[model samples]
Target: MEINHLTAAEARVWRAFARGETVDFRESPDEDPADGGDWGAERTLRAGVLRALLLDGPRQDGEVPSLSVAGARITGRLDLQHATTDHPVRLRNCHFDEAPRCYAARLRELNLSESLLPGLVAHAVHVDGILRMTRTRFTGTVRLGGARIAGSLYLESAQVSAPGTEVPVLQLNQASVGADLSAPGLRTQGQIRLNGATVAGSLNLSDARLGNPEDAALDAQTLTVGGDMLLRHAEVHGWLGLRGARITGRLDLSYVLLSNPGGSALQASSTAVGELWLRKAPPMEGTLNLRRAQLDVLFLEPDSLPQEVLIGDLTYTSLVPHEPAERRLPMLERQRDGYVPHAYEQLTAAYRRVGDDHAARLVQLAKQRRHRNTLPWYGRLWGLVQDVTVGYGFRPMRAAGWLLSLLAIGSVAFALHHPQPLKAGEAPPFHPVFYTLDLLLPVISFGQEDAFAPSGGYQALAYVLVLTGWILATTVIAGVTRTVSRQ
Candidate 1:
């Protein structure tokens, strides 16, 4: 219950300002300056008086401000808890001793450009217009959690630095904004959390510097954004987490410099987006983990792909350049620990989903070839032999091709036999094709192999055909088993 004291000249300034009239430090322009000698001294205003004026003041449409108090430093905390106002609060280059706690307050617009504030607590506060804080410096944490904003929120070139190390500098958890959230050229120390927040327009953070070496710098878990999240040409020392987010537009991180060293730079697990743009000149340098992400278009250049990035379980519908199976080689080649089965499988499935079975088989073939090359010398030899005979279970028709070739060669040898007789002459079913099939197949009995009695080279060739049948049949069985296990 502290009372605010005002001087005689300051009393006149407040009366004129509340009446929608203009007044300088001394008096009106018609009054003489010699009437007030101490008007040249600097003025100090209490926080309670500023809060009262904001609640009771009426804004007239003119060149004059609604409540313009220049060169005055606020003493106590301006607690406008749940107060509703319609006028715009414009405070320029002023200093606040404590943070203005406008919790659940309904405001029209707030323009604190070039001001120095300790912090700001506007949780669940409704604003119909923009919250402009251009070039302002916030020494403490600014929590705008659950706030609803109709217009844009501009923090252009602002500096928000908290005293602690691990906590977030700006908290916007569950906050909903209708327009853009432009924080270009902003320099912040701790993390900027936007967990479960919804932004209707774009979030342009281009050319900003976010540094938090201990942990993630921007934790935007489950954030639903209507437009782009532009971090182009920005620099982040910590991680960028967007796990389970739904972005309507592109997540543009082109030319963004991020370094988290051993940890993940961007963990976008289960995120659904229209397009993911990482087509930078030098590419991103950190470990980008995009597991379980579904994107319509993913634009990635060959040179820009990082050596340690991972896209396991990621499914993209349309890749650029039309031929994605061949064009996506650089990304798979850049894996750190070599072959990842899910990455290749996901890409192959995407191509198959688009009705490109030819490209899908090519991707499967490429995955096997690249994986075999990374194996040891003995393993590579075994893999190559399996591929030549059976196509690594990817082509079961190759095993059929081998069986048909052997059957044709053996059929020609037996068809030109010198002496071929039937057993007991009981109307023998001995033909070239039926006898060859009996020799190739182990289970089927066409009574042609036992009925025919061969001599000279035919008998010796029959022994080779019997062994070749088992080998080809075993190869086919092995190929089928391998395919079943993979599925």
Candidate 2:
């Protein structure tokens, strides 16, 4: 129905939409327009200068269709309170110079695509269909607090300019979305807050450049996503805070460059993700905080093939035990390149818990290689010895050396205690030779009287000689046994 004629109330709404003035429904006349069942449909409100005031009460379904306010400069509030639409509401290329309020409006498939929106405000705005805003430019604060969207919300190529002129930027606080929130190629100069927003589908921010060196950037707190959160190739010049955010699927951050040289860069505490992929990302200048984050096996796979994957700082439980040399060597080698110091520390801690101090120290040393090779040759030799002793179970040479040392000590103690008897034509036995033979030998035999006599020292010498011969024979026998076994 055509609404060319203006009653006092209709005239006020027309003047508000035309001049961008805020209409205070509380202060307006008490006449109820819907009581007469005459809500205007297909209404056109053209160019006007609007100011600050409220517009209350609900509008009938299909009561407003194809409302166009093209090229109009909205300087104040424009509240479409509790308004429901059956068809798409188009507001193409409208310039909002001041804060425009549209609280609790039920908009189905609203199209503000390519609109120059600056300082726009929408609290509790429920959208049923797609809210398409392709290439829209938001220069000041634009809020969508407590809004619920049922379909895909596209903000493709939208440029949210810096908030320097006493105004803030886009905010979507406590908003819930049923489908994906795609914002590909979004360039935000000011902060874009999406705190406590829930998304049923993926949150795609691919190729989005956010924040400036002098201003605050994206602040997405407690954002819960059912699907993957893709931020591939996105560049954040300031802080990108995602504290307490939870993603059920993988958090794909491949090729993302987050540069906050002077401030905290990326903070994602208590965040949960299936896997966090950071393949080919540039070296982060600031902290990439993921404190108390849970990661799965997909994040721990080797970065090369037959196991080719991206290698980075990862914190996870040990995949190998402390005793197996074969299993631990591969993991050690993986830390040779791209090893984050904190991740290496985590790995070492896990190893230490399994009583694998040698492996723990090895990883620590490998991580130190990034800064300086402070480990000396002797230190590395000691580390190698410890590794072999704990990991390989190869300590035959060590056992043999200890056994020989004990025998030498015992022989010396016996020689000093008992003096040799002077034979008529023979000289006293040489002590060194006796001790050496006793240590090197494996068998000894002596009569009881000879062992107890003053001449027992000579007998001890004889016992050492016989033991040396027996040890040589046993070695020869063992060699033959091994050869026969091999054959």
Q: Deviation in angstroms for 157 in model 2?
A: 0.7
Model 1: which residue pairs collide? none
| Candidate 2 global TM-score | 0.58
lDDT tens per residue, model 1, 260-333: 77788888989999888876646554777887899998876665665677777788876654555677766776
RMSD for each of the candidates:
7.2, 13.0
True-structure RMSD for candidate 1: 7.2
Candidate 2, run of 10 with poorest lDDT: 301-310
- What TM-score does each of the candidates earn? 0.73, 0.58
In Å, residue 161's CA in model 2 sits off its true spot by: 2.1
